[model samples]
Target: MNILNKTILVTGACGYKGTVLVAKLLKAGYKVIAFDIQWFGNHLKPHDNLTVVKGDVRFPATIPFEGTDAIIHLASIANDPCGDLDPKLTWEVSALATMQLADHAVRNGIKHFIYASSGSVYGVKEEENVTEELTLEPLSEYNKTKMVSERVLLSYSDKMVVQIVRPATVCGLSPRMRLDVAVNMLTMQAIKNGKITVFGGEQSRPNIHIDDITDLYMFFLERPNVTGIFNAGFENITIAEIAEILACKTNAEIITTPSNDPRSYRVNSDKLLATGFKPKKSVEIAIGEVIDAYEKGILVDKEEYYNLNWMQKAIL
Candidate 1:
């Protein structure tokens, strides 16, 4: 499929990853219809090829899917904290809305549907590294909804090229930044508070740079024929290792705190790599970019930049 000039509808287009993905799509010559609720406010600049729409995923019927060749579903109740706040909302937006959009896309004759699932779906694993074939043991409502959405989307594979990418904890500098993620949180805490706390420091989690994940989405979007689920994680590192890296860079002391969230998993991305997709971005690179962003005043210290804080306010 020659993806050039193709119109794509991107849900959650104002999100941490969505803002970056929208810019990439526009630069790559794809006409983008950026649909989002603008939870953090729109940072995307005006573009002739870009169309921004303010909307909610919970009510997918109201969303316009007209003349869209592909759909990149990225909208949801994002993280564990937010997901736990209202599991009902999580199910409605993440699981139900996802299927609703998928059905709409198929009915509208859309060629590709890319769902941004998460590697967190693998949950706590005794295995060294969980592969695509492993049975998913999602620990949180967020991941559980992701699992359900994946199944729903895959069921429509015959009608459209339904693809799911299970990305790791995405870390990097974005126009709309998120400070609640593990890597970002640790880095930000070190910079702002002069201390890095590792809650359950030994727990392992796979991570990828934000740019790498968006680039992979474009990779899948361009190749419309390629379908199925693939893990989008690069390397599995411990929480303590991340804290140490930030501590070394910022001269901050590492603090260990007891955590109730003990979920940990190492994801295998060999299937994705076998397709010759190389991820150039690393956590070290992401940390540096974030630090640079902070120094330059590109990112600010605000509650809205954090998902949990924002969700609490939004729901109330």
Candidate 2:
């Protein structure tokens, strides 16, 4: 798409994945407009072509959409527990805001729209391979919001290149690191407490390294023609399997406990791979990198790292 001179607006630019993606965008020489509520604090380093805007996505008019060639919508309440805390707020930020943004994008003549949807939207699938064709059965308010947002964005596909990526639970390090997800959370537990907790270990969940998922966004950004819902997870392993990998790496104890959560499914990214997108990282590599960061003092266990804990204190 020759994005060298193109300007891209990235919502949630201060978030876990957003921070990394924004940085990469700038490094790749694309003009970037970073929009965020800054609920967690902006960790994005200053760049020559970067424009950081503190604004709410609910009001699309407030966002600086002028001269924007594409939109990478990443803003949302994020996670099941945090989304559950305020269902109304989640709907406003996650779903309605997306509708507003897509409408604005169409009006503004922004051609490329890449949405960060959740793999959790296909909630609790019985099939071994949960493809994008499967009917969405969103269980939580968060999942439902993502599902609704996807539908809303898809409705505008004719006007713009609507590329939706249903990414698996992301792991690895970021400027705004999150220890709440499966891989990062268990890795932190093993590193800090010397114990890895496994709840309902048999339930398989798909996972992708943070780098791969972020890279997938850039992939979609460059190829605006390749549009549609595509899963982005590479590893489909159980909770126990993840814990065992961490335990071996950190010599931590594996503690099995009962879990009633029950939400589990393996996401297949075959469609994504067929489009020439290659995943270069794994869960084991993510665990190793996180451990390296912790040991090197680049990362730590903080209140903001856990979304539910921080959101309860900051937003609620």
Candidate 3:
């Protein structure tokens, strides 16, 4: 599965993580096809090796099984808030279609298939931190669908090589930007308004940069034999520490509130590390980016943010 010169298809290409990874793959000499139902066109990466295909994954026409060496499944109702918006569509497109994609790819002779699962699958790790072996207790709709979809995809292990990477709450830069995440939101609030609302600071959740996430995919794409599910994330920090540091960068105030343990506990990515993979960007680096974006006046309006509506519906 050496991606060099291999034709690779990246779903959700316009998304934060997908966009970054698509660019990386294209730059690394992989034949890249980008697919997405919609586009933040202004943020689209202009590349010679990239071919943009506007399509949805739910429909068979969009799967593009032919001539595809690997399928990176990133298309879905990503955030918990967005998934709960329309439960039925979420399953049909995000969960059910993953199974359909696997069937299409494997039956069509696609070599490698990767699923972007979430750390939220491990709800609340009763024991301080969680690991890949921990039993899943997904508390939200998006993660529930992810867990179900993962099971369905894994069923094809005998037919074709399938791999899953359960990334922690991803933060940092993206072409199609989103500030609905904890780090992004805190940095925006502190910079614009000089204050940040903190919730459940005591809870430690694993976090990783958007770039590092793409790196994980590249590693697996190059070494397809590295199969199975692996956890991805660097340090597990509490909401309070994040708020404090973000405020430090912005010279803003910190506001703490009730339990807002929206997703999960911390996770141990040791298993993934054993695969000779180390995250290039850390949580601290993500913080720096957020602060830099804030100072540079790039933080968009709350209403204009892609994830604002989704977050409001779920958090409220």
Candidate 4:
């Protein structure tokens, strides 16, 4: 699939991951239509090939799907806390909207659909390597919505090439920076407060850099034949390990505390790697990038950077 002159429709285009992905699409000579609700604010710069549309993904009729060669679905009530804030809204935007979009793509003769599914869908797995074949035991409304959305999209596999990526907790800098995720949050705490807090430092979590995840989207866009659910996390480390890295880089103190949240899982991206996809960044690199961004004043800890806080004040 030569992406030259092809138009790609990206949902949640102004978001943390979508913002980076949209920019990459435009640079690769693909005409992009970025659709978003703009809950936080639009951070995407004006481009000749980019069309930014302010709209809700819940309303599929409002989506600009005409002349779209592919759809990269990234819109949803992101994270567990925000999804739990309003269960009805989460289901409407995440699951129901995905169903409608897949159906609409089929009707409009769109041949490719790439979905952004979460690695957390394999909730609290005890297995050493959480593979795509593992049973999904989603623990939150957000995870359940992603699981349901994946199933819904897979149903249309016969009609189109469906690529589902179960990416681990994404970290790193973006045009729309997010400071709420584990790596970025702890890094910011170290930079701003000179201390890093680790709640149950032994709990391990898988992570992928924002650049690698967005690059994976471009890889999928070029290879429409690679269709199925594939994990995209490259690094699996403990909370203490991440904190130790940040502490080393910023000369910050590490404070460990007890935590009731024992949920921990390590994702394996062997399947995705087998497809010739190479991840170029790591969790430590993501932390370093965030620290550099803050030191250089390119990023800040804002109220909107925390999804739960912003949604509580504005949306909820």
By TM-score, how accurate is candidate 4?
0.98
TM-score of 2: 0.98
Question: How well is each residue in 31-137 modelled by candidate 3, as lDDT tens digits?
Answer: 88888876344356778877888887899665676888888989887778778877888898788888888888877898788889998888766776688888988
Instruction: State every prediction's TM-score relative to the real structure.
Output: 0.96, 0.98, 0.92, 0.98
- 1-316 per-residue lDDT for model 4 (tens digits): 5667699999999999999999999998999999999998999999999999999998889999999999999999999999999899999999999999999999999999999999989888789889999999999999999999999999999999999999999999998988899998899899989998889999888999999999999999999989999998999999999988987898999999999988777888999999999999999888888888888988978999999999999878
Worst 10 residues of 3 by lDDT: 307-316
Q: How many backbone clashes does candidate 2 have?
A: 0
List pairs with backbone clashes in candidate 4: none
List of clashing residue pairs for candidate 1: none
Ranking of candidates on TM-score, top first: 4, 2, 1, 3
lDDT of 2 by residue, 176-285 (tens): 99999989999999999999889879988889998999999999998988989999989999999998898889999999999997867788899999999999999999
Q: How many steric clashes between backbone atoms does each model show? A: 0, 0, 0, 0
Q: 234 in model 4: Cα distance from truth in Å?
A: 0.5
lDDT of each: 0.89, 0.93, 0.80, 0.93
Off by over 4 Å in 2: none
Question: What ranges in model 3 sit over 4 Å off?
Answer: 1-4, 39-42, 260-264, 297-299, 302-304, 308-316
RMSD of each: 1.5, 1.1, 2.8, 0.9
